[model samples]
Target: MPVASPIPLAPVPPMIGGGEMGDLVRDTDWSSTALGDYSSWPASLRTALSLVLNTKGIAALYWGPQQWLLYNDAYGLALGDRHPAAFGRPMPEVLTDIAPVLSPQVAQVLATGDGFSIENLSMMMRRHGKEEETVWTYSFSPVQGESGGYEGVLLLASEMTQQVLADRKRDRAEHERAQALLRLSELNAGLEEEISRRTADRNRLWLLSADIMLRCTFDGVITAVNPAWTDLLGWQESELIGLSLFELIHPDDLAHTQQGASLSADGHAYARFDNRYRHKDGSYRWISWSTQPDEQQINAVGRDFTAERESASALAAAEEALRQSQKLEAIGQLTGGVAHDFNNLLTVIKSSTDLLKRPDLSSERRARYVSAIADTVERAAKVTSQLLAFARRQTLQPTVFAPAENLRALASMIKTLVGAEVELAMDIPEHSHFVIADPSQFDMAIVNMAVNARDAMVGQGRLIIRVGPARRGSEANEQPMMPGDQVVISMTDTGSGIAPLHLGKIFEPFFTTKGVGQGTGLGLSQVFGFAKQSGGEITVDSEVDQGTTFTLYLPQASEPREPRSVEAPHELVHGHGTGVLIVEDNPQVGAFAMHSLTDLGYRPVLAINGQEALAELARDASRFKVVFSDVVLPGMTGIELAHEIRRRYAGLPVVLTSGYSHVLAEKGTDGFELLHKPYSVEQLSRLLCGAMCTHFSRVT
Candidate 1:
């Protein structure tokens, strides 16, 4: 049992020199002050002042109900021009400039008979002769007097003005960066919309360019020239029209121009050819060009590069700009597709929420509506998780575990999900050794492949999950994975196989063969991404009327996995008034947890964020046996908090909960046990109790 240290009505240490403040304290006008004469001061005041004044820390003491102030030399400098004369004055007078910020803290320490701390406390005070912004990390504790009452507040503080300002600066910079990215994204999206809206107008915009733009027949007879031909080459639009394109090119540049034109002859096109065109004055001007062609005519756009001709860098830069434009066009197309999918999901969620608002709904209908909302939410989360995974933004937490054991464990669940008509087969060995991977993601990948297989079989066919070890294998899937000792798991379906035409697109996001509402097209892509991220590879094999199979090859771990301690599920213990800190940002979720914990005979503290939870624990860390926190929380994530707690309090266990988090998905949750969202009260209790019980036994 931890015992509280009593607040003594004495000095913090041995009585000694009071540093520079001692002379001023002795000479102060105490006769006209709250404590009468300085020499006749109470022993508690003298001892406390002496201890505080002698220390190097910025310490101070507020003595008596009047709160007489005293401080060391370190704190005296903080007083600016009022250092010496400020000694022994009532704290209220001395602290008049910062009273609003300091008073509540002092009152809190006195009211609770405990210490109060504020980090980066901001204040606008008359410091250095003007009102200025100041920040500090400060602490105040109640000091007991000779009569054992709350005498004053002991002050311990440090200025954090610079650090606070620096942090604000960084936050502003990050905000700006985010805004810039958002603007870029919006602009990219708008560009796509504009292009789609003006496809026909775009041809006119290109044809009437400031640089030369023209159309010609297959035999090179010029059909049209924009105003740019007249502006640059001193030729009327009518004069340029009906002439052969070869007549416009300078004699020395004709060969190169023909080479470019020849390439565009068979409905193929080429770009970045440099040549010269004849001006009306007979001089030649250099031009760099791009051409597009078809069976009837060829279209060309050119920009004058005469002045920049000596520098090849300019030509290269122009080519790069053209390439970038094409890339953005492709990206815009992808974004449009993603937006369509997301909007469909939002429609379902929005309609469900609006329906739930109707008070006349029946319980069964309400339940169905709620289930619809949950399903859509889960689907949305999975889609986002897969997107993050493909972008390599998800964190992976890898552990060494035998693939064979887990495959067997998931056999029943997989069978249930695939339905009764499908015959399930497992070819897993008793022990295929261990492999390193995120077990959760690995399980998800397996499930995704199995579901795809089940669907391919139309709910009625042979689905086989085979696990084994191999040194080398055929790369039927064409993925380039490292070749060495490996653990391979294959999910095979005995149904109509994928056609050759669809093979390349099977792993593309949003490319699904399932009917309109049946699939999200992220499953295979997620599997592919996960395999690649784990230093493994996934491949597919299929033939029409035959079967389809997805094989995942993972590098084998060098060491064997240690078996877990076996505990009977029925023997799980219950909490006996165990103190738990529940850190959840959602009020409904927090209230439910608190109520559930109370019913289970546990003392639960509800904190809406990681900071509040830390403050509660800091007050009396030993009172809490466990911390249950949402993975995504304000200020600090559950994963980060768990790390901090493990550092500060070794014996404490943290149970992190999340429905879906990019951080958790990318950076695997290790050390801390994860509790997925939508968990039951019974599940929470068992996890909390099991962790506490296991850790307690380990400590003993």
Candidate 2:
């Protein structure tokens, strides 16, 4: 029990004091413990006991047997409103809901006089019209009597539910975060592989590109170069690094190259430019350049134009030569036509002169004049033959033979023409390469080239003839000479090369550099005509003071062909059975042909023109075995007359002659054969016999 403080009381009133005099006076003994049953006890003693109970939170409980109890405002709140009258009720009634909850606790406290404690005790209890679930720390203590036996149990508790729930929610969130992290790791790996693959592809593309690519800074320092750049320039990375780009330009083009670069750096690009670049071997190449520039860098691509430049230069030269060739062709045509007519006139004049030289005239003076006329006629004939050869109008007997051997055969003749000072060098291979062309024409072509080379060298330089195969194009087609073979006859000279101006016209007739009498200017023209007719091409390479190389591309022959050799027959026997019809516009020409046929023992009927020939053929088509007609007549053409003849007598052998061979050559035909104008008496007879014999054989 605890002691209490004493309070001093005032004196009571006389009327109230007398009535309660038997119990106590106003100032009774306050130290006494007993009241009610004994008058000697003080009233102060009762008040003292009440104060001690209230101060210690201890209340007196009235129960039939021992049970649990609690003290203090905190313990009352734990029981809630259900235990409102707790001081004198039974413990089970006071805490009806807590009876089960405190049964074990009460029993333990009763057995042990010492207090007991329970940690994390949980319970669901009703409070404030709802069930509250709570976890708490709790303690239960036993109240002891004087003998120390258990009297009741005291309860104390504390709630702790919020902290545990918070930790579990945090754990779930961390697990999800870990899963997302794993997914992100996989995605990163795939991205790495994709990036690596793209890098390799870009690198390969850069290396294979044909155009050189360079990445450089604005200051003109090259930072990188593609494989094409390194391969084309023939320089390694180390050798090119830190070298000024101007050093790559040729000495003559250095200023222009710098100007172009400067312009590009100033944000203005020169889209196209041409300059010379020095090769690694010190040789120069023409380069055409195009550039694309941006704020930070410039990209340039250059194409090698050396070949194209040379071709352009060659084409310009060829055009000039074409002009000269056209001029020469005009002259040759005029001279040839005049010479052909003059030869006919001379033939008649010379025949008359020969008749005048008969034995009847014995004067020396008259005989000398006749002999002089004959000499003049012979000279005139030689001149016409030369003109015909130069005009490329003469016929040729072509055969397959090696040009190298042919040139060797003419070595002595070429030496005589050039003079002893010039050294002749032959680079012709020993292996036989055959070409189909006239042997005489082939010889003449080589001799003419050698003569030109000799003249260009001033009779004191090396002249070389090289023969080999040259590809005509991408196809493996052989070079064609007179339309067949693939070999080139190259004539190179050590003398001064042809001038750029004259190189093209070098093949034109009468276009000469030689003094008046030194050359007829017909050599190269004849060579050109022979090559063109043989379906060959001639290309010339000449540099001032270096030398001239003339390459002749000819069709290669499959096998060696025997040289063309013909022996004239001794007898001039006429064809008596070969009946021929002559078609002509001019009476003189017609008479000449008729008489020539008559002398040759051929029965020939004459017609004035194609109309007359057609009329004659229509009258008696069976009488003519062959019809020899001139094409360009006064009325219809020779072809029309032949068609008319064929319509009447389809089996009749018709031979057509023309002055313009191009007209017939342009037409494709297997049955039609053509003979050009100015045929001799023998040609006419032979052709007639050949046509009649062929027709008879076919009929048989």
Candidate 3:
């Protein structure tokens, strides 16, 4: 409805060039509208105008010849005490010092016939009598008067010193960026050359390595070969280049080599193949190859195992043949020697007994003859036992004890056996030396050696038994019997020394140089057997007409044991007066023991052997109180018999008697009550009394 009288609008500003405003609105132009009545305004008003419009509070000012009329309170305060006087100053005179320092923007605008301005143009301004520096900016524009005539110039300026400095900093940053870009271009140009140099260096390194290296395509075509690869094959790298790896492989090994290469290519991180490769001279050598795949190529390294492989094969063959020969030699020696010794033993026993049956022998002579026969037979049996021990057929009864004490205990007997003709000496230290060995066997070993030494001295030379601590060094050729210390017992004789040729075989069975009945070559062998079986070693040193020394090294004991003295009565004595059972299969032996017991004032029960003894036991389990039996019986053995008796009579004193101690005393096999064979009336009596005393003492 109001459209009829729609708008008679006020005239718009002249459109010089069409735009949001007009092209005439220059970026550098600063124009202002008067509020009202300029003539009526006072000096105070003028001052306020200078701060807002004349100065650069929010507004800026321009005057003649593009001079800076005034900035603002911000600009004036920066000018300080002479602010108002600084108004309307010529732009050159006002900023003569600062203009030179500004960028070329002002000069450019003036020379180009264009109104130049910037909303945040920055500059540093130094006012008179000021100690600190300040920054500002101005706009340069042509002036026009009301008469439409060209006047001077005008300036619309703002203090933009912080902004101006920031702009200059941006320009410096752009220049630095350009220089950096130029350096980067140069670095990129050298990158390819550096990469090539590193690759060459890596190739040289691979060539120098001990391992043979090769680079190949996925198809097994050799692309590059290191000097190691060429040297190992006795060929040049050029000869291998572009050649298939299969060409170098032995014909029989090609299939496996291909399989490994295929596996490496098929996503296996690495694959290995050991095979024979053909050398340049047409020979095959062992090579262990390891390969890894990378994208489309394969890298491989190999080792030559030919020399080691051939040596191992030869060694294996030699060792196998040697083992067979050693086994056969040992068997042949044992068989041939054992048969001869057994026949000789049989011959001796037969001949000795045959001579004892002469009819002219008187009772005394007959008794002596019978005793000699028994002694010879016993000696023959010992020979067999020693042979068994050498053959490792004899079981040893080992106990942990001091070897020194065992040797010392045998001192008296050794002295007696050596006779008063020879001076027997001992060198034993006072340390607590130990050994895991059979005390009786050890004693016998010492005695046999002493007897040999006595014989060697012709019963008249000095004999020295030396006992000391020793050990094998870490670099020793021989293995130690035990983990630590060893007790050495060496017997030296200053008599007829052994010949060098005879030294090695002195410990061999039946190898004596003496006439028949003078020596049993088993003496030294027995010593050897006892030492070896007891986890020890024996060494003999002898020189012709000089002397001989037999050293026995026994393992040392690990811990301390209660002190014990091996004492036995060798004279006539009384029994325990307790009930004693004498189980003997042999009538003569039994009657002699029975008479001995009667003489000892002890009650005796008679049984044939283990059978009769066990029967008497079944009849009355604990009636007899103490069972004395022989070790080797008719039906059951003595140890078995002890077990049976123990079942019926637990804790009953069972005394085991043996010839040469079948179950050794060291092992504590039977009970503590054991009577060694050929026991005198006194020994039998003492053992019986001791067992009874021990039994009653335990019971009480």
Candidate 4:
């Protein structure tokens, strides 16, 4: 074999002419790269590299298995910081930031021997000193070697960042302009539809409304009238049109109507008033007008409320009649109850008196009869007091006292009243709560409620009396209480609740569900009266078979002054021949008083009326030790007489007495000692002695 002459080495390919990238490629140590030296490079890679280098656009070749980078000056310039150092590096390493996006695309082109192209391909590149967002139109084309196998990938790119941004801006502006125009058109269409709808509605209202609609000039000349005017006033719209609106108004209403018109003329936005308008039959109909003022004109709607007014008047009359009927019925019930109760009391008294008159009666028997009479009289007095309380006409002595303290004091008494079978619990707050009210009446009310609760529970359930501070309207179910701080005393009982049908009438005097002798029914009534008279409200809530709660809200009072210690009861003391002036209108009562005073060892003088008493006093005022007068007199009232006596006789004690006097109840005792009627001999003696003692002390 001819010694194989050393085949001449293949000549090196000419260096690419890509300016800066070309110079870098020529100087690079390509043997160190996977693509090897350019002298051994495949024909296809050399051709691709030549095209990429000389191309004006951005282009690069990723050649061989390693996919080494060979980019043109334009592509190198686009590479920013990566530049010449990237010339001979592997494509994945050189384009590290975009490898994720570029690798798969390049692999696809190489494997399929296909070309891939995309527009606006976004890449984050470290261009300058920092990574920046750039967009480009780029493609990857496969390069084939001499053996017809895919060698690597060729990349061509054109930056689209500025172009794409500008196009998007212009498109956005056009879209916004289109949207604005569309909204404007919609607004115009909607406005037209709204105007048309409103106009149609106005026309329909004018035709169908029952109220008389009219337009008038500020000067009161009618410009237009709707058809309702014809139907309402029996005046045709044509007849009313162009006529002075004031002509149709009743003479009595003309002045106010003109004044209302002037308000509209003065540019008041709205005016509402009631006036009488003339009907076709010469009768006057009441019309309620609501007018709106427009430029130079007033549009008014007049509703004919004549029937409403007439109905209101008729209703009021009927209500008054009903009230009168109810009042009469209540009076009948009260009269019947009082008669029945008093008859029982009088029967005992009459029997006792008849027995005491017997000469053969034993001492003990005579004493028992007299005691029975006295006890019966006391019971009758209590009945009258309850009646007065229920009527809210009882005298009240209001003083500032701690309700909590009072409740605590009465807890034991309440327990006894509720009995051993019923559980009685008191929830009095630790802090003191003060209220201005009659303490005796308050205690009585509580006892009455306790008795009522015990009876409702059949003497065998729970009674909880809770006292706390409250604000008016703080509770949703409570009645409308006066707005202020309030002391709430609530009694809750687990008992058979009151019937709904009876709730409203429970406060009415003599109204009761209890059979004959079981209850007088004045207990709750008295409580109700006391609550109202004390400037407070009482509310009850109950459910059938469940329970009941009676809540009393009293106006809270400021902390009271330290209370003075109560004095012990005084023993019955004789008058010791002291002169007593007795003024009484009733003959029988006056005679009884004189006898009682004399029996108590007092010298007594009688005057039938206040003027007679004054005359007697003028005769010898110093003769009387103390003046005792009945409150209701023929000429001047007892309260008036008391004032006169005080004015005339300084430091002279005048004691006023009454069964029931509106003046005394309303104006109070007027700083004078008062004795309730139906007094016992002992009571009379004690009061007279106390009054005299007080006077003596003052005089001394």
Candidate 5:
């Protein structure tokens, strides 16, 4: 039996090569565990352990009734911080955090001898320092006993904590994004409602507006119109929609309307103009329009102002009527002044004539009476000349003369008129100022102003006369001057100023503040008329009890050529049988003219009219040395007759006489000698002699 000593089998080698974990399994004390000793373990349990240990993925075995833990190297790492201590522990103690979830699956596998798997099972465990959430997929399989009863549970596991956490984070992001999209959708809906409301409001305004609002194309074709268009223009919208806007415009307004339309078409932002539009009843109404260009069309608003225009025209007519009434009043005053002044002159003449009629009158006494009559006649002629000047009817012989020189020449006369009581001062520029006006009238105007100043001063104030060049229409002028270079003649007086009430009427005929008989009321009026006729203006500035200044603006003229030297006055020459033709329409004037020419030593012929005179001349053209004709004739005018004579008888000279001839005033004497009416015998003689001399020279 000693020979029968049992041969001991070599210690059983580890069934798996799991590296470090396999070595740990060999070193582990399974004796204290429910699985007991490894050498004495059942084949079923041993085989299960071996299979789990050799598994490449994470795997573990729970053998025996206690279901103690036995794991491979891969399964050990899934334990985190509890690795080595949980290697051989009972499953309930080793995975206490997931025991409740894993116990049921393990029991089911053991009882049925079946295998099962769980995907993404969640659990809480203290694998590290503290308890944390974890996810895993697991497989459970029953290990069969040797005798065919289930022994314990086998497990395959994979940790899914990272994949599960990432999926959960992605799901949270998707949910928040969906909420933001919903809020955006709600805001868009509210914005859409606001836009609809505004559109409705604009439509209401378009329908309810009272003004005539219209839309037209750039070419002026009406595309749309509001109700006001019908109310104002009496045209239906349908009827006007396709019509050209220009067609409804009055003919006289078409050009302006077209111009405005063109400006709009050229991209002008806004335009305003007034034009007339034809109404349905065939009358035109004035329409003031304001338009704005937009895109390819024009938007316009129109208002009717016809009633306002009619009111303005009525006001103008009323003003003209008032002016005419005032003119009639001025004429009445003028006639009254003329009658009074003429009666005084006539009384003097009548007395002088009656005295001369006394047969016992001595030579010296007769001469004195005659002188009185002559003086009265001279006064009457002066009155007539002033009236003519005030009426702007006198024929003016305009010459270009320097105003400064003329004023200097008249200083002595002005001094005499103003009296020694008043001081006279002059401010005249050395540079010459020339004007084309009647030299005598200019002098008379200055004298009249001086007299007015003297009267205003009551013979004891200073008078300052200033002469300077000025520009017409300059801002410095108180009254508008004629458009040209002008010479300003200002007379400023330190005297009692004119009252505001009488200032406006000072230039009216027969309008004056002077005492009756002290003035004819024609002085300032003559100045006014002369200044106007010569293309000038006069202005007055005054303050009550202070002073007054009268400024006369006369158009300046270019310097004139030196005048011909005048021959000294000589004895009147006689015509000496020179043939003179007298053309007069009035019989008495014709006879008087014939006698006067005969007395002047000229052979005279008389004709009642221009036609008769022409006929007489045609009969014997060379028989007349000169033709003298009245300006106003029954047939051909003096100007027309003279034109004919010049063409027919080139060598003949003509002399015209007129008191007031429109032809002479407008057209002037056409290179012919003009003799004023009511001429003295010496004047007639001198003029006729000159005409005859000119005729003789031409013939020779």
Candidate 6:
């Protein structure tokens, strides 16, 4: 209901009105209205009409119970198609569509005698030949009679439909612009991540290459130098770092190096740039360099191709002169440049294995990093195996399994890892559903996510892991997904949310918000990688100071995968007391191998090299059933030894071991059963027994 202010009635002065409605009011026959004939009208109604008729403001009056409509010319313009027809009719008759809407307001104004006003109130009225939505600002005031009581209501109104519609369109356009900016922001972040990855790869290449390499800022400050600096030039990395690169250059070749350095600083990089640097032993070494520069730093690889013969030196100098004169363009190729991704792969394997050798390193993390080392092999093969591994990231052996069950199994461990401070919650549905993914990787991803959430909450908050059906029609972050029944695994946290600026980069490799060395920034990246690789996607929703939710949408599998059957668990396979020849140069490793083999029911014979093993075999070839050898040996390499044994002993099995070697990178394991060094008794037994069992089966 609406209310209206009181309008004091004044004396009529026995006259008519003025303005456009003056002539109409003077000549109208008001007999049809409830006010009766025009001459019989009361002075109070006439005075109110006289004032309304002469007024400049838009006003209308509803007099008597029948509500006869009277308005000045200003109000008539807003009355669109019903202006003249609405002159004498009742207000309800004139606005047939909106009578219900206006009747209550009119009744309230007359009863309450209090003024009411509203802005942008919606109404549906007949306009443009159809019912159209409208917005209006109007005030209803109660009109008074000569007795000083309420009579009828006064109306003041303005239409705002056009302005409201225009503003809505503008707001929608702005929203679209914001979305576009977000996509652009994401693209820029992706480019930054690519550059960062390339930089890390270049750093690894420089550090591991069998050459002289240095990393420097654009301003000529050397930040890092390869270990070869000490081996080849008799200068420690600490002595050379923080010094200007130009300080060690040969005076004769300084001009040439400076020119190349200048070009690199300006982003023009080329291969085959040659120069000379003075060694700490007072001799000059001829070095060839290839450098690439980004905004922050320069990555340069240099090889010293010193000549032993005078004639060779002259020939090299002539070739270098000709090469420099002919080379004018930079090498724009990116694919052929990652020189030693293999070294990085080997580094990971060696580092993780070394950690595994420690008495206190936990088994879970050892398995995790070792698995990471295996994944690193794909990238290493890209350069050495002539296969594109970076082109096809992560190789997974996916099987259908229920995510809810896996989570439930791991809940106790997760709670322990997150500590007792944070509350853990699970919201899995009662019914069962399954998705296709790697089981080990699935376990690892969840642990990584739980640890990440724990860190985000600073070790105290609610962490929720939920599983349910994905909402198919809703598009998250405007990403398109495969059409299917998708299962979702959602991990939500009641911690500080990600900012808009950081949201676009949270999944990039090596991008982290944690302090240096605290995070690898690969947890969420692996989650995203696995989701996409398994034919699904991941989405994040966050708000500052509130919380975040990370959802993994995976295509639901129609049927559950059959579980693999294991014949024996925790069973040590034993040899049948046949002689096992162990070829190893390290005395400690040889003694350990002898003890382990004897413990496993094999009569072990120890040898220092391949020749000793061959001699042992020749003494009585029938006594030796298997030859175990390390890949790197004193006189003969293990790979060369394997070839020799294959030639001499056709039926003997050769098992080779190494941390990682150039031979393995180039030619691979070459059909021999190979094991990485520092293997556990379990892994060693598994390989040796499997090899022996295979040989026995083949012979029988």
Who wins the TM-score comparison? 4
Given candidate 2, what's the lDDT at residue 506? 82
Expressed as tens digits, the lDDT of each residue in 335-402 for candidate 2 is: 76456556765776777677676778668756676776766666554444444555555444466788
Clash count per candidate: 6, 14, 13, 0, 0, 3
TM-score of 2: 0.43
> 1-700, model 1: which lDDT tens digit per residue?
1111233222233334776676555544555555665556667777778778777878998766666677899898887776666677776677688866676667666667788778887888676788888898878878877888777788988988889999999999999999999999999989988887798686678656698888998777999888888888999988877899898788888787777677678777866777888899998889887888877889888899888875787889989999999879757856876787789989998998899999999999899989998788787777776765565555667878888888888999899989999999999877566789878888988888888988899989999988877645454534344766678888889988999999988987767889887987878888888888788888788998899988898878977556677774333345678899999999999999999989888999999988888889899999999999998887788888888889888989888888768787666787677776667788898888778877877899
Question: Which model scores highest in lDDT?
Answer: 4
lDDT of 3 by residue, 553-625 (tens): 8887776656567444344365456567888888998888888787777778889878888778778765676
Ranked candidates (lDDT, high to low):
4, 5, 1, 6, 3, 2
Report the error of model 3 at residue 249, Å: 22
Q: Candidate 6 residues 317-352, lDDT tens each?
A: 999988876543212222223333445568887887
Winner by TM-score between candidate 6 and candidate 3: 3
lDDT of 6: 0.76
lDDT of all predictions: 0.80, 0.66, 0.68, 0.84, 0.83, 0.76
- The sequence of per-residue lDDT tens digits that candidate 4 reaches over residues 1-700 is 0111123233334555767665555655555556555577777877887888899999988876667787888887888887767777777886789888887777777788989789897788887889888899988888888998898888889999888889889999999999999999999989989999999999999999988998999989999988887777899877887899899899988998898889898887555689998888888899888889888799888888899999999999999999999889879989999998999999999999999889999999998998999899888888888888877788888889988888888989988888999988888878889898999989888888888888889989999998888854555445454867788899999999989998788777777788889888888888998888788878889887888999887888999777767454475576778998999989999999999888878999999889999999999888988999999998799989989999998866899888888887777898888888888788888888788777776688
Summarize candidate 5's per-residue lDDT along 210-287 as a digit string, tens digits: 778889998889999988878888999899998999999899999988888888998785556799999999999988
lDDT for model 2, on a 0 to 1 scale? Answer: 0.66
Off by over 4 Å in 3: 1-361, 388-425, 430-436, 451-463, 471-481, 494-504, 513-518, 541-547, 557-697
Superposed Cα deviation of residue 327, candidate 6 (Å): 24
Candidate 5 pairs with clashing backbones: none
User: Which consecutive 10 residues in model 4 have the weakest lDDT in total?
Assistant: 1-10
What does the lDDT come to for candidate 3?
0.68
Q: Once superposed on the true structure, which residue ranges of model 1 sit more than 4 Å away at CA?
A: 1-433, 438-444, 457-465, 471-479, 492-501, 542-547, 558-564, 568-578, 584-603, 606-612, 631-637, 660-667
Worst 10 residues of 1 by lDDT: 1-10
Off by over 4 Å in 2: 1-416, 419-423, 434-440, 458-460, 471-485, 544-546, 556-571, 575-578, 634-651, 656-659, 664-677, 693-700
